[model samples]
Structure formats: structure tokens, C-alpha cells
Target: MTDQAVAAAVARRFFGRQRELKALRADIERTGLDTLTGRKAPRARVLLVAGKPGSGRSALAEELADGLTDRYPDGVFRARLTEPGGDPVPTARVAQELLAALGVAEPPGAAEDELTELVRRAFTGRRAVLILDDAVDAEQADPLIPDDPDTLVVGVSRGPLTGIPDVRPCTLGGLDAKSAIELLTAFTGSVRITVDPQAAETLVEECGGMPAAVVLAGGWLAARPKASVADLAKQLRGLTGDPLTRTFLLAHEALPATAARILRFLSLAPLGRADAHTASALAGCSVSAAATTLADFAALGLVSAADDGQYEVPGHLVPLLRAQLEERDRPAEVQLAQARMLERTVRLLQSCRAVTEPEGSAARRKLAGLPRALRFPNRAAGADWLRSRQPVLLASARLAVADGELDTLARRLIASFVRALAAHRGAEAAAPELYGLHRLVLDVAERRGLHRERAAALLNLADLDARTGRTKDALLRYRLALDAGRAANDPYAIGRAMESVGGSYQELGDWQRAGDWYGRALAQRLARDERADQARLYGRLGAVQTYAGRYGEALRNWRAAAAGYRRLDDLPGHARALSEAARVQEYAGRPEESLRTCEEAVEWARRARDTRLQAALQLRLADTLDRLGDPAAAGLHRAAAERLLESRAAACEIRSGFEKD
Candidate 1:
């Protein structure tokens, strides 16, 4: 499928997160062409997206760029500072290119100051966007600066750009564990994430949310189908830098005398967050070696892996690699390697964040050439592979964030987990997964300063709680979520929270309270034309009405719900409606009609493989038989219901004479 189509499909997989997306969108909107420049009204806005490598700084920038590009008619100007082969963009050359993009000619081999002036003159009055990706210190971006008062300049870097004064800075961190796993599920599909959730959780811890490491581990696991989450986790735990093991070893060993020492010493980093000077100190090497190693690591896809000169280590082996690289047995002549590999890895991951997959002949070729283990054949196939590699993805995200590297990719990845539930595994079977993911995402979103995401996470968790019989807790969560939605200005989130509150009341058997909340939710949802959720709400409303002994009203709502489900071709919903109709007949003492309805429910349940529904219908059938005075036959049907309920642990339990078979 096309990338946009794939993205749309991926988007459809999310169960929630409307609140956060709305807030993020608002934030993007707040960042007007002039806003990043602040009150000084400098000729140009030099906003910097700063974070450790793998922190998803690039993704966040891309998100803003994706939404804001339309506002700038001069077009978005993007340039790669770090090349795959590990070359830094020369200041003069970069300036020349920027000038050219702005439709200005630069003097060939112009002096640094001249080039800088040339670039400034090129965008004197234009509303173009300049994205300088994979940047180093501010000095490197000096020549390529935008001069126009209407121009917005975005620079993505691994660390703070100390050289740039008066630039608006945002430090990115890793995705939340839940978001990371969700992204994994979204990319890999359901089969993998659902099989072993606990293992997946631990794996997310291991990788620590370094997107590059997460992606690498995911790619590795995806390359092998039968592998378990624990299996990949075991591998991550076992990664050590000693004895020249792992793909990074040969590269490390082959590094030039200066680069090798810097990299080796950087391995001592505890948190794996680093910069060139940090690497130099750890390696006992000079600044030059550290700089060279930064470029070298990018070429090897170990750190910058782009021209950005942003240094980072792979999250997967950060601890183990640091230990091995720091431990003794080094030749006196051979200096220690760097301590900043982890941060470099974070940066590389930031550069490599491709959510909807790559495009174009060049990009396709570039993706195709990614190490066979690294390249995903297609978005669908990649999603399938990613699903199986959830543990690794989570680990990567956690590592990046916990390292305190200012990466936000891990958090974004967590947001995508909503996709994992609805679209990846659907609502019914993936409930447990959805519950845990929402819990984690909620916590992380709040901690990462994402109020909108926090509300969405809370709402999502409340839904799960209500479903699983935690009505009181669900109500509290929903209330908090509603407050958060209001604070974040998310009307849709507020409506959803209202619905969840109503659902909690229904679950608690408080029909009046439930109806009131549902009414408000329905009104809001109706105004929004969110027909997607009408079927479910109507079905739930009907159930509440039936339980409250409003049979006629229940029948009306049930019929409407049934029609909605039929339009959607939802067999399970149809069966539920039929069963509800049967319950009304049974309670009204219409044995004949009840029996017919029960039979239809039974057929539908069988086709739907809904053991719970079948059990409930069987129990209804037994009750009807009892009404008909066939005690022996009633007992047989009751026995069958008992067997089904006990075996599958279906809901609607009854402590009848035949609770067990």
C-alpha cells in the first residue's frame, strides 16, 4: 500500500489518544513562523530540537515540519549534516547549498563569513523553513543560518548547541515503554505482542528506549519468526563489548588510533549519554579523536550515522558495552575508547525515525541497502516483524529516556501503542495488553510533560478498568482524565472521558448515574459526528436498560444497536443483540419466542466462536426449558452452560444447581 494509506491504516489501529494528539497539534500551531524567534523578532528563528541520540528529536521535528510546512510557501528546506558514510557538511559548502535552495548564487569557495552573509541575504524576506538535521555545535550551523524575519530554522542535534545563542531549545527523550511496545505492535502486528506481554515489558527495559537500538533489536527479532520476546531479551542481556564480540567490536577495533581510544573510553558511560568531550575524557584521547569517532560511528550506524555529529551509543549494549570497553586489558600504547557511544546511538536513531516508511527511488534504494537484517520489505511485513520484536522496541525506548538523553522518540513510540490494540489485536483479545500499555503510557506521558497524552492515557486505562470490573477505579481515572482533557483543550477527549464515566456507572449497576453521563457523552459525540463509536455506546446503553428492567426501551435500543452492528458486519454484536432479545422474551415468560431467539444466538455464537455468549445463551435456553416444565431437559442445558462457562471462564456466571459439569 501507499505510505499515506499505510499511515492511515496504522492510525486506525489506535484505540485512543485523541487528547494528546490534539494537544500536540495545538503546540505545533502555537509554534508559528514568528513564535520560535520570541519577542526579539530576530531576522530569523533558530529553534533547536535537542536530545541524545535515539531520543526521537528528529521525529518530533518531522512532526512539527509535517504540520507546519503548508504555512511557508517558500517550501521546506532540509539538509543532512551527517552522511551515511560519515562525512560532516563543510561550512562553506552547506552555505552554498542553502543559498542555492533560496535561489541565490554564492561565490564558489567563499570565505566562512561571506557564505554566512550570503545565506542570511538569501532568505531576507521569505517564509521558508530550513531544517538542518543532525547538527553538531552552533558553530557548524553558523553559515547555514536563515536571515529572513519570516523564515523558521530548525536544527536537530544530539546535544545542546552551545554555540547558538538566543535559540529556542527543546530536549527530546525516549518514548514511554507502553508507547514503544505499541509502536512495535503497530509495526510488527498482533501475533508477537500478544504472545508474551510480560517478556515484552522486560525487553523494553533492556533497550531503554534508544530508538536505534530498539529498531536494531526489533529488526533482529523480526528476521526470526519463531523467536520469543524473552529470547531477544536474553540476547540483549548477554551483549558485552569484550573479546571483539558483536558487530560493533570489529568496527571499534578498526578505528584509527585516536578514534579507537575515544570510542573505547566512552564505553565507560553509566547512563550511556555522551558528547564529544565526554568521549575524549573517557578515552584519555584528544578532542580531535572524539570528533573523528563521532563521524566514524555515524558511518558504522553506531552513533551519528549521519552528518549531524551527534554522538550516541546503542541502548541495547550500553551497560554491557560500557563495562567491556572500560574494563582493563588494554595495551598501554592503545588508548581507551570513548564513553559517549550510547548518546551517539540515540542520535542515529533520531535520524532514522521513519514512521510511515521511506519513499522515492533514492530513499527506497537507501532503505533497500540497509543491512538485510535492518531493511523492512514493506510496511505491512515490517509491521508484522515489529510486532514480534516488541520487547526489543520497548527496551530501546526505555534506555534512551532513562539515560536522560533528552530524546522524545520513546514517548512517541508509546503513543503508537494505541494502534497496537484496536487495529493490531482488536479490543476483546488484547484487553490485558491494552490495559498494561495504557497504564505505562499514562505514567510516562505525565512525566515527560505531555499533559494531553496523559489524559488520553488515563481515559484508555479507565476504559479497560470498566471492562474488567474495576468500576470504582475506572470512575476515578475517568474523572482525572476529564480534568486533564479540559486543561489540554481536547473536546473529543472530554467526550470520551464522559463516556467512560457513564460506562463505569453502568458497570457498577448505577443506571441513573450511568444514563446521565452517557447522555452527555452521546450529545457531544453526536455533535462531533463520531459515528464510529455509536454502535458500542448504543449496545452498552441497551444492556444497562435491560438490566434496569426497562425492557421496551431496551428492545428499541437493542434493535438500533443490532442494526448498527449489522451495517458494520459485526457478527459478535449481532449475536449479542439476539441474546438480549432472548433475555427479554425469557424474562417475560414467552418460552417459545425465547427458545427461537436463543437458538439463533447459539448459531451466531458458534460462528463467532464466542464461548461466553454461547454459555449465556445456553443458560437462557435452560431457563426457558424450566419455564416449560421440562426439568430433565433444563438440567442438560444447564450442564452444558456450566461446562462452557467453567472451561472458558466466560462471564455471566451463575451459581445454579449446575455451576460445574
Candidate 2:
């Protein structure tokens, strides 16, 4: 079958639940449409499918959705309400997921109630089907369900959901004996069943009509094409313990040692879905070997191949695999697996940074020797990968924190996440992730007694706070960072904290305090021979001086900054310095000197390709010419500035429209 055909078949696979299916259809029709008004009925639009573990509730829900696709033309959306380990998924997160599927974006860190309202608004007039699978209880499902009668929600769980209004609950049991036999036949092919119908029936009876058990049994039989069905049935009949457990044990024991070990290690993967790269890390083997093992597991029905080329172990089987992993009790092996995964993540993140970082940057140079496999081809691909894998990376960082043994790895992971976020998404969009990562880094640093790391984390948090308009909070964090840096005896950290504190003070409009802090930072940079940092500090000092109405002091500082930038061969810095010097000259009533400096600034801006800077310089030159009573020259400069601004505005509008489209 084609892939679509196979997917459709899987969705429509209902062997012998005719009675339940009929009742479900009846309920959907009865509650869905209003005969009196010829419109959607005013009812709680929920169909609850309740069943035991491995009883195929999820499958039945999918089949029902497939049958009603024509009814819900907007689309069918699915989300798991429980984690792979059976823990309840957070309600806010479920709302976020549903809202995203509905093409509505909620703000970062939005409240649960806000997200719930957004979901409700999204479904207000939409005809959609929401299949919330593996739901733990009604509390988990309440906020996610839309109140719109036109929408339909299918809630699948291990038992009936309570507290939901007017829910039509369909409780399911295991498949019937004949249906179980058909399921096995569907998996193992009809030839084997036709060869020995009695043995197939016996095997179904032994499986107690459980679809999962029957599928695994069929997989076992399918793996051995020459083995007689009668012989397999006899072997099933001879098992001494629970049939499901025995079947799982038999399937697991039959695997080669390497494959079995890989399966056990996969139990540790978050969400029970792992790609070849993750499997390679977990199994401490080559990616090729891991890919082969994952494919083999998919063939054996131990896992399903996800659309993204990852493999997902069934939720019902995760507990069993975890138990088997614990039974093996190889702490050393588990530790090694974890370390390898962390290392692999680190290498991949390094490559992401390398691809996105500016050319000739220290960050790019540091990643020069990264392995080819981990490298991304371009910035766009790297950014796409980072966006797609963000959740996984976040989960891995949380896991590292909980484990505590990989403290260094956790710090590195969080740092890499911050860098990746800043590279792909700007600081504003990355604020929430950066906030979380900085907190995590602080936790790791404090636990490990790494004073320098703690100081760095504090500084980063302070910078984010300042950027987000929390100047007071930023000031507090900067002080803490400075204290920690002093304790660590790191001049660079101390200088950074001082400069950041000055920035916060400047944001608060405290020019005097800002100048003082800048002077202190400059002292440290000079003592450490950090010429680049010293030059930047000089510019910062000049800004505070200019704001304080000290034109002479500001001019002196700007001149020093220009000299420093020239020494460092920084064209943009020199241009900015020249612009500031011209402003000081204008304030000092030296129009001729200001005009000369402004003209020089314009040339430097052109060399730096900073059109905005050039535009500002032209305006400054026009102002100086106006003060000198040269109206004609001033008019020309003003015209040039207006043209530059118009062009910039047009470019911005074009970009904005493109983004909107």
C-alpha cells in the first residue's frame, strides 16, 4: 500500500467493534445536529472513549475521527494529555499546543486562563475535531475543550472522564476472539492464517483478545516465516505466567544482545521518541547501527516510525521497558549512556552556533573542528533545526538538572540554548527561554560552587531584565553579580557586571551614577589590558557626560573614544565616535568644527555601510550649516537626509508586508 493508504487503513481499522461504533455514531449524530433549528445542537460537544491500557481506546478514537472527516472540514487535531510515562500533561501546555494547531499564537508565559480563552475563541465558529488522547482526568481536559457546539472533542483515557457536562462516554473492552484473530492476520499476512486457522484461533484465545498482545504475537510469528502456526500456538500455550507479560518477555528475549540493550536504553529517552542521532548517543554506537536497530524495532512493532523519521515506543510498553531497564541495574551503563547523549547534544549545539555566528567571530573559531556529521550546512538550516528541537533540548536540560551528576553538562546545555535562541530569534523573542536558562545555570553553578559561572548567570539575567524594562530588578541583579564576580576574583566578570549596572542606571536616567560605574569598569578594563572593552567604555562615559550637559567633558571623552577605536581598527565604532564628537562641537557653538566632524562622520558611515548613521550625520551637517547661516547648503543636506529616511521607511514597509504575507 502507499503511505497514505496505509495511514488511512490504520485510521479506519475497526475489526469487530460494530456495536460500540454504531452507538458512538448514533451519539455523535444525536448531539451534533439540531433537527429543530437545522444547525449545530447546543450540547457539550465531547465524545469520551474510555478503556483499559492496551484496550485500543486511542485507535478507536482515531477511527471515529477518520469516519467523520467530512463533518470536521476545518481539520482533526490530536494531542496527548499524558506524558509517555503516564504522568498528566500540564493543562496550560495542552492549551498551548491546541492553540498553536489552531493557528493562534499566545504570548510567552501566558496564564492558563488566557490560553484557555484563546483556544475557546479560536474554536468559536470553527468546525474542528480535537482528539485528546491518553487523558488522565476531566481536570486535564476541561480547559482544552471548546464550548462551541459546532466543534467536536474526543477524549480518550483509561476510564470515564468525570466533571464534564453532557459527555457521551463509550467504554471499550478487549476485542472479541474472532476480531483478535483478524488483527493478527492483518499483521502476519493472510497466508499463515489460511494455512492453519485453528492455530490462529488458539493464539488469539491465548492472547485473551488484547490487540497489543495479538500484534506482538503476530510480529513474533511473522519474524519466523518457516515456523508452523501450530508450533507457535503450542509454545504460547506452554507459557507459565501472564500471557501478555510472557509474550513481551519472549519477544524481548529473542532479540540479539545489542538490539535488546538499545531497547532498554531507549526507555530513558524523554517522550519515548528518539531519532537515529539520539539512539546513537543512547546506545554508544555508530549512527548507522542505531538507525538499523530503530528500523528493526519498527518492523517488529516494538516502536512506530514517526513522520519525522524518529521512532516512538508505544505508551503502554514504556512502563514495561522501564521496568526491564531497572531489572538490568547497570548503573555504569546508564551513566555512560546519559553522558554520551549530553556530549552529542553539546556537539550539535556547537555546530548550530558555528553556522549562525558572525564570520571570524571567536564563537565561530571555537567550533572550527566540529565533526562533519554534527555540522549544519547553513544558518537557515541550523535555525530550523534549533526551532524544531527546542522542546527536546529544554527537556534534556531539565533531565540533566534532575540527575545532578551532569551538572557541567547542564550548564553547557543551558548556555548553548541561550546562544542558539539569540542567534535564530532576537533577544526580545528569546527573552523567556533566556530567563529560564539563566535561572537553570544559576542553580547548577550554585550547586557546584562555581563562583564565576554564578556571576556570569547573574549578569546575563540582569542584562535580560534591563532589556525588558525592569531597570530596578536589573540593578539588583547586577549588584549581586558584581559581588559574586569580586568573590571569584575574575576581572572580566567584574568589569562586565559594572558595565551592565551602569547601563541599568542609564536606563533609569541617573547620568551621574552611570558615569561613575562606567569609570570603574574602564579602570578594570585598562588594568586588564582589554583595549576593545576600554574603547567601548569611553563611548559609554561620553554618552553620560553628554546627557549631563557637560559638552567640554563629553568632547574630550569622545575624542579619546575615537582615538581608541582608530587604534583598534573598528570603523563602526570610529563613525559613532565622530558623530558624538560633532554633537559636542555643535553644543559648544563651533559650527565650522562641527561641520568638518559631521562630514568626516558621513564618510566613515559610508565606509561602514551604515545608512542610518549616514542619514543622522547628514541631519547634523544640515543643522551646523543652518547655525552658520548657509541656507542653500543646509537645504541640500536636509534633502539628502529626507531621501535616506524615505528609502529606509519604504524598505521597512516592504519587509513587513512580506512577513505578513
Candidate 3:
């Protein structure tokens, strides 16, 4: 269904909260509607729709937002401020999500404070409504509230945001009896509700008039058309505290044994959401069976089914389900179940990346051997699966690492996550999360005394730092990684760490130290006969030498890199190396020689089918020709270069459109 259709369906079923909605609307308009006037207040109006779990506060906030779309024409951006595990989501991550929802381009690799500031600035001039759900405290909500009076911020939290200035709080409780009865009538139909008004009232009382519990009771009653409301009320007659919990327990007791077990394991799902695969893995059942059970649960309001085919256990239901899991399953048994689910997740992540490999590649062959259900059909399909499942996949990694007993599994999970994320979303795009996951891996490695993995993790973190221009910080981590590499006797890590240190020094303009580190790294690669590393280090040395005014040495090193690429049969790499040589030739005041070299580099780039490289080389040729007193030839080359770049840009735009679609 379209989003509007779904929202309409929900609005039709929504009952009660009339008075609360009125109060909330009043509170939102207390400072006057932002859309009405151009007058700017000191800050955005913040209204806290405070309630306990199962109080329907989130729904109320959604209803209010839906009604106010006309008032906030700019947008109604929503963000969840807490994780499924009840931990507060970091303010920076929340801000990042908000920024995306606001159609703002977040600066990649930005610090937490910077992202928070960006989010605030994005909403400054816009007349919009920001719905922050499940916020735990003032800190989580405060950073997100915009300063513009033309905007409004509606926060759904457990209680008052104590430290937030001028915040209006609307605490909620049970729905009124009349609205409660009407809600029951909608679920079970008016005929049954009308015939037994006393029984319906008893059931409402038993549910404590909490909208969520009443809905559960009504659903349970509706499912058994033969059962009366009094029957459910009698079953709950003597139950103690928390009507929602009691109703959940009663509904759980009625489920078939397998369904009940699956329901209990649902609590183990990452972020309280599970699809058929998740259910099948957790319950040791077939996907079809799991899907059927989930559908039934959704019908009974035990879980909410999203359009994407995943079922979400209601926030109030998670604790109840967890309680059932603890009562019925052993600790070891629970751990095994979690392990199975995580293992299945890892296999899925593997498949998600493997489908992107060449058809006859080893990864593709391995994918073919997996179950048909696990294999994706194509690269696009694989990427889509990875994108859709990233949240759960990341959550699973966190849980695995925090499990503490699953260090080996956690390491494997983190590795697969890194590869999958990089395959689907480029490394630069996934760098922020990758940095954190690498830290988790480092934590595990340190705890287990695994020096090799420690070096690898440190190197990964250092590379991200280097990417973001933190040269000094990256150099420190590279040095530490080098130490770990030596301790582990990992030759590859040692070479990479040395080369990276040199790169950092080059970025910091310490040409002498950079050259020294590069030479040290070169020696190791040469001793091991690692041609690729030798070529890479030579290029690194060439760059530092060029920066240090050793043009002759740079030209020689670039030529050597070109030769290495030739031996390795890497056309694109060969082309790039030649282009570098041509640039250095021009820098050395040999324009005629540079012209000839650039022409050859352009041919090589064309042969390699590297459009951007060819265009760059063409531009270099044009510059050299212009310097050599050949304006006609220079203009011709310049036009050719423009055409090449335009084609490249157009191709990139097309590819980006496909990705977005």
C-alpha cells in the first residue's frame, strides 16, 4: 500500500485521546502557529507527549503530526532517539538521521558536534515539525530542537524533559471509558459489543482502559468469534499488576506450542523486528511456517507488520516476550538460539556481497552452493537486500560483540559486515559505522590477545582518520599498528603500516621522514618479492620526492610504477602511472617532452577504458601544447577533453539515478 493509504487506514482505526489531542494541539499553538505569521520567536515550540509504554503516546504524536501537515508544509521529520534495547541512541547518529530526513546533505566524516550543529542549522529557516520519539532525557532531545520559532518540535518521551527550557508536557494515561468501548467495538464489531455491554465494560476495566491492552484484548476476542468479552475478562480477573503484561501473558498462553516458542524468541530479534528469515533461524522452522505465524501474530495485534514484510513486536510487548523467554529457555539454550540467528545473518551478509562478484568467481560459486533462499539473483538485488537489512545487521553485530562469549563469531560477523558494507555502500559512505565496528573488533582482539587482528583494526581506523585529513592522529595509530604487526609477525600488516605512516608524514609535509618510512617499507617488500607493494611504495616515494623538489627522482619512480603495472597486466594502473610521469615532466620545464608523454598517456587511458583518466591526460596535453606555441592543437585537445569529461559525468549521473531508484 502507498504510505498515504496506510496512514489513512491507521487514522480510521484510531480512537480515544480526543481530550489529550486537544491539549497537545493547544500546547503546540500556545506560542501561536509558526505557519501563520512571519514573526520569529526565540526558539521552536516543544511539546512533550509523555506516557509510559503501552500508553499509545507515539500513536497520538503521529496522529497530531498527520493532522498538522498543512500547518507544517515544510515537512514533518521523525526520528527515533532510542535503540530497541532501551539504550539512548547517540545524539550525533540521531542528528544524522534527522538531517537526511530534512533533505540536507550531511558532511561525510564529520564530528558529532559538527553533525549536531548541522541538524540545528538545517531547521533554522524552515517551518517544519520534528517528531522525536522514545527520547530518554533532556540531553537526547535538547540537541535536536531547532532554534527557529517558525518550526515546532514534538517529543514523545516517558515523562517531562526536566532540563529543556519552556517545554510543555502532556502526560497521558488510560483512554476514557466511552472511547475505550468504541475502540473495542471497532475491533470485535458493534454487534458483539452491543449485545454484551456489561461484559465489554468489564473487559475494558480489566484492560485498565490502556489503548494498547484494549486493542490486544479486542484482537484476542475478535480472533475467537465464539468467545465472549466476559470469557477474556474472567481469564484476567485475578491477574496482578500491569494490565498490558497480563493480557500479553494470556494471549501467549493461547498460542500453539510452536507459535508460543517463536513468539518468545521474537524478543531476541534485533531491534524488535523480524522477517521470515529471522523467524525461521530463531525458531528452527521453515520460512513458510515462520511467515504464517508472523501473519497470525500481526492479525492478533501481537506484532505490527510493515509493508516490507517484517513484523515488529510492539514496544510494550518486547519486555513481556523477554520474560517468557527467560522463564522457558535455559541460558545456554537462549545463547545457542542467538548464535544461530547471528550465524544465519552472517551467511545472508555473505550472500549479499557474493552476488556482486563476477559470474564465475569463487565467491559466486560459493553462493551457488548455498540454499536457494539465501542467494540473491544479481548485484542490484544483493545491494538492495544489504541496504534494507543494514539496521538489523548492524544491531546484530553490536549484540554479538557485547555477548562477550561470542568473540570468534563477533569477529567473523564484523569482518563480513565490513566487506558487505563496502561492497554495497562505498567505503567512504560507510566509514562512520565502519570506524565503530572496527573498534569493536579491536576490543575483542585486545581481550583475546590477538595481535594480528589488533594490528588490522588499528590500521583500518588509522586509514579512516587519514581519509578525513587527521594526519597526525593517523600517524600515531599507524605507529601503534606497526608495533602490533611486529609483535604478531604479520608481514603484510608491517608493510602496510609502514607505507601508511609514510603517507601520513607526506600529508604533514615531513618529506624527509616520509621518504625514510617509504624506503624502509620498500626494503621489506623487495625482500619478499611483493611486486604490487613494491610498485605502490615506489609511487609513494616518488610523491614525497616530488614534494621535496626531486623532480628527476619522481620521474624515474613514476616510470618504474608504470613498468610494475605493465608486468601485472593492470591497464588502468599503467595509464595512471604514465599520467603521473607526464605531469612530473611538465613540472620539470620539459613542455615538449611532456606533450609527447601526455599524448601516449591519453592513448593508454583510452585503451584502459578509463574515461576520467583519459580526460585528465587530454587536458594535460592541451596545457603542454599551449605552452609549446600550438594554440590550434591546444584548442582541439581542450574540446576533446571537455567531451570526455561530459560523457563521464553523464554516465555517473545515470548510474546514480539507478542506485537511487
Candidate 4:
């Protein structure tokens, strides 16, 4: 989607921000609208929309960005600087997300400074608008500001961005009476307001002219269409304490018994958003019933229907709901509700992954045993659900771990999340989120002193670090994993950690240390009689030896790997090992031997039905033959390689066509 379209879809309900918008526009104009006129301005103009959490700061900023899309034709980009748990998102992560939206491929594992530079470079020559939402402070907002004259940044925050230079602050308060009444009418209809105009005005006043309060009051009246504005006004007047609180209490009190119970349980929603599945799980009710209740809640404005089809408790109402929950429910009851929700979420997550498994597999069989209500229709639907619920799922994991008593459930949740995400979106695509989940697991493991779980979490996190080029960090985590594994007597973790340590050293260009660690890991695998791991370790040792310019040693290790694979009946592995041996032969100045090795590898690749591998070996043979002064054989091999490539391309085209059809 275009960035402008993304910004426009940020929020759907905007009622009274005209004065704020006008002031923001005037600030932009004062900085020079030269970018709109096809000329460079002095610098990017920043407008900070500051207000309390419930005051609609984010929505106002979104509206402003949406309106300026024409002036900033390059496009608009938006990023949330705060996480769901109200944690400040790291500057690097914010930069990475924004860079992706800007169509820039961020270098993996880049530090904040580098990513900040990339963000600046992306906006350097463009006349675009960027919306930085939920910024907590100047530190979180400063690095993201582009240095381009043609850019505009609208920052949304609960307070002014104190140290940002030249930021025009537009502080928001309650909405105006007319706009507030209009917003209320949108929910309650004009008939009730018209029937008793004075009572309607008094009701809006009781709501303190806050859009959220007005919506809740309007919703209460809407649910009871026969109720008059004066009656509702009198009810609010009778309540005590905070206006918003009183509004929430009155609205909540108006719910049916079951609906009221569900509303109280909604405080358990991760990020204040829940769907039918979770609602059913939380309340121990049927999915359809929960769905109906949620729909009713949406109609009553107790919750709003999100674009993802889940119901979201308005940000302002969340605290009130939480308060009500604490008051009406015992701690034990709350914990039970949370456990029920998480347990059900785990089952649904399992079903999500089971749909992707091959039919008749254990996973699929287990999925079949689950009630139909828990199972997704197919892989596509499951993946879509998983993608849409990503934020909530992550928040669930965070809550589970923080609870300190649901370690087992948290582990299952993380494992299912990892496998499901990998099956649907690939681990690399979801690396950032996976990284956070792993950290939570590690935190729980460390606190509980569970060595095995700690070892596993460490290894997983270390692998992610290595994939993103943080070799030193990976090395440290690998060492810790090794210690944890030893403490827990986990042979698999021990062997894997040793091998990973070697890989990290190899990445750091420490050939001797890499070889030593690989040899150690190889010994562990051999001792444990792990044939597959032993073969893999041999290949890794060969790679390290090759990097060290020890051609003979590399050849010997590769030959061992090839023999092991042959004994194991793994044709592809045998072919790959032979290919590596053949390359080393060439590197060692034995062209004839390399040619012979390549020929054998090609036959093995063909036997393995690996078209790409066979084609690659064929090309390698052609080069070796040409070096050996056999031009005719080289030409034939080149033609054979071309045919293999053509066959592979044709097969891919047919597969694509089938998928499309």
C-alpha cells in the first residue's frame, strides 16, 4: 500500500481537532510551504501534538498527516515509538520499521546511529510526511527527525518533546461543546438530543466535553433507545467522583449481566484488544456466544470494532475497565481468567501451525482431535489470523512471562509462535518479534533457575544474533548456553553450543579458534553417536580449514563428511560434500583431480535429483575442463548445464502457473 493510504487508515474516528489542525498547518506554512511549490525549504517542520492519553493526540496527528498528503506528494510514513506494554521502542527498531515503510532494505543488526543515518538518507530528497506516534520523550523523537527541508514530521505524545528544536507544540484539551455533541449524536442519534436539547447539553457537560466520555454516554443511551437524554443526565448527576470514571461506571452498569461480566474480564485482553476466540476462552463460553457479546459491546461503545475484526477497548476506557476488574473480581479469579485465556490461546496457536502440516501427520491428527471451534479452516486463514493477531500474541507472551507462575504455558506459547511464524512468514521476516519473545523466555528461565530452558533460550537468541552479524554477542551467548547446558546435563545443547561457538569464531575470521571449537564439537557428537551431527561438524571443520589455507586438511575433512553422508544414505549431503572436496582440490592446484571430483559430484547430484546442484557441478566441470585444455568437453558440459537450468526454470514456471490457476 502507498504510505499516504497507510497514514489515512491509521484511525477512523476523528471528531474535533480543527483548531489543532489549523494551528499545525499555520506552523508548517510559517516554516515555508516551498516544498509544495516545487522548491526546497529551510528545514523540515515538526509539529508536536501533545495531550493526555485519552485526549485523542494520536488520532489528531493521524488526521493532520492525512490532510497534508497532497502537499507531501512523495508519501507519508508512520511509526509507533512505544510498544504495547508502554515501553519505549528502541530508536534502532523504530528506524528499521520506518525504513521498511520507506522501501529501504535496512542492514541487519545495524546500530542505532547507522539506522538513524539511513532514515535521514531515505528522507533527504523527498517531500514526504512522517507520523511518529506515542513518543514518550525527546530522546525517542530526536533521532527519527529527518534533516531534509522537504519533509514534515508530526509527533504525537502525552507531553511536549522537551528538547526537540523548533517543534511547534499543539496541546489538546477536551473537545468543544458543538463537536462533542455531534460526536455523541453519531453514536446516540439526533432524535434523543433533539427531544430534550437542554438535557443533552447538560449530559455533554457532565462528560466534560471529552469525546471518549461523550461516546460512552451516547452508547449507553443508544443501547436503551427508549431512554431519554434527561434521564441519562440525571443518572450521571447522581454518580460520584471523576467524570470519566462516573461515565464508565454508568455505561458499564447499564450492561446485561453476561455482557457486564464479559466487560470486566476484558481487562485481561492483551493490549486491550480481544476477539471471539479469546473472549470465549476468557469467559469459558462458546465462540459464537462470545462473538455475539463482543458485537453487542461494540454497539454499546464499551469496545470499538478494530479494522482487524477484533474489539478494542478504547484507550481511555482501559484504565476504567481495569479498575472495575480489580474491584469486582478477586485476585484468584483474575488469575484463573488469565490462565484460561492463555491456555486457549495456546491451543488456537497449535491449530494455526497444525493446518500447515502435511495431512495424516501427528500435528494434523492432533489438530483433528481439537474441537472444530478451535481449528482454523485452512493454512491461509490460519496464517492471516496469526499475522493479524501478532501484536496481541506478543503481548500475551510478555504477560505470561511476567506473571512468574505460568512458565510452562509461556514456553508452549513461545514455541508455537516460533514454529507457526516460521511456517507462515519465515523466521527472518519475524526476527525482531522472535527476538523479544526469546528474551522473555530467557528472563523466566533465569529467574526460575531452569538450566535446560535457559540453555535453549540462549542458543536460540545466539543464533538470531549470529544471523544478524552480531558475532561477538552471539559468541558470549553461546558460551553462556554451553554453561547452562552443562549445568543441566543436556547433551544436545552442549553439542549445539560448541558448534555455534565455532561458527561465530569463523564469522569473526578466527580460523584456528574456529577449527578448535569445531573439533571439540565433533568429538562430543561422536561420543554421543550422533551420526548426522558428526557429519555436519566435519563439513564445518573443513570450511574453517579451507579458510585457513590448509587445503589438504580441508580435503580430508570433506572426504570424511562425504563418506559419512554416503553411509547414512543422504544423497544430497554426499553430493554437497563432494562438491566442497572438488573445490578444495582446485584450490590446492590439482585441476585434473578437481575435474574428476566434479564429475563424481555431478553424478551424485543427478542421482539425488538436485537439478540446481547438478547444474552448478556441470558448470564447475566445464571450467576445470577448459583449464585442462579439453575445450570440446568443456563446451559440451556448458550446454548440458544450460539445459539443466532451462529444465529447472520450466518446472518453476509450471508450478507458478498451477498456483495461479
Give lDDT per model, in order.
0.62, 0.82, 0.85, 0.85
- The lowest-lDDT stretch of 10 consecutive residues in candidate 1 is 333-342
* Model 1 C-alpha lDDT per residue in residues 409-461, reported as the tens digit of each score: 44555445445334444567555445545666666777776779889888877
Q: lDDT for model 4, on a 0 to 1 scale? A: 0.85
**Model 2 shows how many backbone clashes?**
0
Model 2 residue pairs with clashes: none
In angstroms, the error of model 1 at 200 is 50
Model 4 Cα lDDT, one tens digit per residue, 235-326:
99999976788888998887877788888888788877899988988887899999988877776666777667798876667667777888
Q: Write the per-residue lDDT of candidate 2 for residues 233-285, one digit (tens) a residue.
A: 78878887666676777788889998998998887787777888889999989
- Write model 3 residue lDDT over 1-661, tens digit each, in one string: 4322332253357788888889888887575443357556677899889998888899998889888988889988899887765778889878877876676766445778888888889998898888999999998789888878878899999988999877888899888889889877766778888888999899999898898898788778767889988888999987777899888888888888989999999999988999999999999988889998887787677888877778888877887788789899889888888888988888998999898788899999999999998889899888877877777787888888888998888988889989998988888888777887888898998999999999999999999888877778889989999999999999999999999999888888999999999999999999999998888888888888888989999999989988988898888888888888888988899877877777888898899898888888888888888888999998998899899989888999999999999
Query: What's model 4's lDDT at 344?
Result: 91
| True-structure lDDT of candidate 3 | 0.85
Best by TM-score: 4
Which ranges of candidate 2 are over 4 A from the true structure?
1-44, 90-127, 143-151, 160-166, 191-202, 226-243, 348-390, 411-439, 461-477, 508-523, 526-535, 538-612, 621-633, 640-661
Query: Which portions of model 1 show Cα errors greater than 4 Å?
Result: 1-369, 373-399, 402-407, 413-444, 447-451, 463-471, 486-492, 529-532, 567-572, 588-626, 629-661
Ranking by TM-score: 4, 3, 2, 1
